[model samples]
Target: MIGRIMKIVSRQYTLLGENGEKHDAILMGKVRRQDVPAAGDLAEAEYVNGRWVIQKILPRRNRLIRPSCANIDQALIVMSVKDPDFSPALVDRISMLIMKADITPVLIITKCDLGIPDETEEMIREYENGPMKVIRTAKDEASDEVAAILEGKISVLTGQSGAGKSTLLNTLEPSFHLATQEISKALGRGKHTTRHNELHSVAGGLVADTPGFSSLDFSHVSASELGSCVPDFIPYLGKCRFNDCIHQNEPGCAVKEAVESGSVPQRRYRNYLGVLEIIQNRKEKYL
Candidate 1:
C-alpha cells in the first residue's frame, strides 16, 4: 500500500494511509540505504509479516534543504514583525534556498499587533513587491485569506521559534493545539518548541510545522548562483561591467547603481550583502 509520511519521530515513521488510516512504518533495508524518506514523501509500504515497512520513496517535485522536507508546493517563510523582531538576513537566506529548489516562497509576516517599526515597514514593502507574495498576520484575527491560498497545496510554515508558526497553524486549524511559548526576554528570540517535522491536514491541504530555520544551512549555495536566486536582481544582473560581478565593490556594477538609484530597496541590498558574505566565507573554509 502507498501512503504519505506525516512525520518521523526517533526513526519511527507515521504515515497517513489511502483511506485516511494512520499507520506506523519503518524503512526497509534497500529503501533506507538508497533514499531517506522525508516528511512529505509519498511512499510505498508493505504489511509483510505484520509490519508496515516503507519499501520505496516516490520521486519528489521539489525538496527544501533546510528544515529538510520534500515534494513541497510552497514554503511559508514565517517571520515576526515585532516581538522577536524581524531578521531580513534570515528571510532572504531562506528565500534563496526555496527558490533554488523551485518551490514558491511566500513571506508570512507574523505579530503585527505589537506594531511595526518604520524601518521594518520599509523592508516589508520591498518584499511585498518582490518575487514572493507577502502576507501579514495579527495575533488575534482570521487567517481565511492565508488559509484560502494554502488550500489544496502542500505548504510548510517555518521561521524563528516564537515567530508564531505553531500559533498560526492552530489558528488555521483549531484542533491542532500545537504548543507555543513566549519569547525569552534575555535572548530576544523564541523558544524552540516545534521539535520535529510533521504534516498536518489544514485548510483542505497538508501544512507541516517545521522546527524553525534557526540553523538554516546555506553552505551549499554558491556565490555565483546567488544573483539568479534573487528575482529582483535579474533586471540589473548581467548589465554589470565585470562579467563575474557578485554585485559588491565591482566597478560599474549595475546592481550597486540600482541600489543607489532607488531601484532596489537598500535594506534588501544590505541583507543581500550579508548572505553573500556568508556563502563566500563558507566557500573559503572549504578551500
Candidate 2:
C-alpha cells in the first residue's frame, strides 16, 4: 500500500497509511537500491516481519538541494532583529532562489521583542509589497502571528541557525524537540545545531526544519534568466529598450529607473546587480 512518509528517525520512518494508521517502517532493499526517502515523500510499502518496509518512493514535484526536501510548497525565510541581525540581501537571495524554483517565499521576522528597527520594517514592507508575504514573530510560544502565517502550507523554515529557526519551530509545535543553539559571542554568527532536513507535522500544515547554510550562491543560474528571478523586476522586464539589457548602466532601463522613482527598493536593485555580477562571472562555467 502507498503511504505518506512523515518522520524519518534514523533508519526507521513513521508512515501515515491511507487509512490514517501510523506505521513504523524501514527501507526495504528495493527502496534503498533506488533513491533515499525523505520525510515528505509518498512511498509504497508493505507490512512484513511485523513492521512496514518501504518498497518504492514516488516522484517529487520539486526538490531543494540545500534543504534536501522534495515537493515543497513554500519557504519561511526567518530573520532575527538582533543577535546576528537581519540581512536584507540574504532575504533577497533566498527569495530569488524560491522564485527560480517556482516556490512561494514567506518572509518571517523573528525576535520582534528587540524592537523592529526602521530598516528592517522597511525591508519587510518592500518584500510584502512584492510577491512575498511578510509577517512578524516573537520568541513567545503563544504568539499567533507566525502560526497564522504558516497555516495550511508545506513550508520550510530556513535562515541562519542563530536566527532562531528551530526556536520558532519549537514555539509553533512544542512537541518537536528540535535542538537549538545560542549565538556565538565572539564570531557573531549562529551556531548551527540542525544537521538535517526533518519535517514536522503542524496543525493544518507541515514545517521542515532545514539545515542552515552560511552562504547562498546563485551563480549556477544563467544571466538571461536572472532578471526574472527578481519578482519586482517582472513588471519592467520586456519594457527595456534592448532585449539583452542587464539593467546596469543601460540607457532607458525601466528597472533601474523604477528604483530611482521609488517603485522598486534600492536594496533590491543592488542585490540584483550583485547577483548579476555573480552570474556573469560564472557564465562560462555553467555553459
Candidate 3:
C-alpha cells in the first residue's frame, strides 16, 4: 500500500493511507539504512505480521532542509512589518532558497494593523512586480485571499521567530492550536515555540508549520550558484558582459545596471551581494 506521511514524531511515522485510513508505521530495515521518510513523503508501506512498515520512500519533487519536509509546492514566508520589524534581506534569502529548490515563494506581510513603514511598503510593491506573489494581513483578521493561495498546494510556512507565523496560522485555522510565544521586549525576539514540522490539512491543501529561525545560513549554496537563486537577476542572467559574471564589481553587468537604473530593487541587490559574500567566504574557508 502507498501512503503519505502526515507527521513524524521520533522514530514513528503517522501515514495517511490512500483509503483514508491512518497507519502507525515503522521504517523497515532497508529504508532505515537508506533514506528516512519525512512529513509529506509518499512511501510504500506493507503490513508485516500485525504491524505496518514503510518499505520505500518515493522520489520527492522538492525538499526543505530547515523544515525537513518533502514535496512542497510553495512557501508562505510570514514577515512582520513592526514588532520584530521587517527584514527584507531575510525574506530574499528564504525566497532564494525556495526557488533554488524549485518551489514557488509567496510573501505574507503580517501586522499591517500596526502600520507599515513607508520604505517597507515600497519594498513590498517592488516584490509584487517581481516573481513572487505578495499578500498583506493583520492580527485577528481572517483573509480569504490567503486561503486561496494555500488551496490545493503543499506549503511550508516559515519566518523569523517573532514574525507572528504561529499567530497567523491560528488566525487562518483556529483548530491548529499551534503554540506561540511573546516577543521578549528586552531581546526583541520571540522564543522558539515550534520545535518540529507537522503537515496539517488546511484550505484544501497540506501546510507544514515549521520551526522559526532568527537567522539563515546559506552554507549549502556555492558562490557560483548564488546568482541563479535570486529571481530578480533571472532576466539578465547570460546578458552580462562576462558569461560568468557574479553581478558584483563586474563591468557591463546587466544586473548591476538594472539596480542602477532603478529596475531591480537596490535593497534586493544589496542583500544578494551580502549573501554572495557569505557564500564566497565559506568557499574560501573550505578551500
Taking all chains together, each candidate's TM-score versus the true structure is 0.87, 0.87, 0.91
Query: Ten consecutive residues with minimal summed lDDT in candidate 2?
Result: 182-191
> What's the ranking of the predictions by lDDT, best on top?
3, 1, 2
Per-residue lDDT of candidate 2, residues 217-287 (tens digit) = 67567777888888889899988898888898889989888899999999999998998888787876656
Regions of candidate 1 where Cα sits further than 4 Å from its true position:
49-51, 182-190, 238-243
lDDT string, candidate 1, 1-287, tens digits: 98988888877999888787999998888888897778889999989898899989999887765566888998898999977789887888878777777777898999998889999998899888776788999986767879988898889887776788888988888787877774234445445777667889998888888754567677767888788777678789789998999998889999999889988878778878888898888888889
Stretches off by above 4 angstroms in model 2 are 18-20, 182-190, 284-287
Residue by residue across 117-169, what tens digits does model 3's lDDT show? Answer: 89888878888888778899998997899999888778888787768877877
What is the Cα-based TM-score of model 2?
A: 0.87
Q: What CA RMSD would you report for each candidate?
A: 3.2, 3.2, 2.7
- Which lDDT values do the candidates have, in the order given? 0.83, 0.78, 0.83
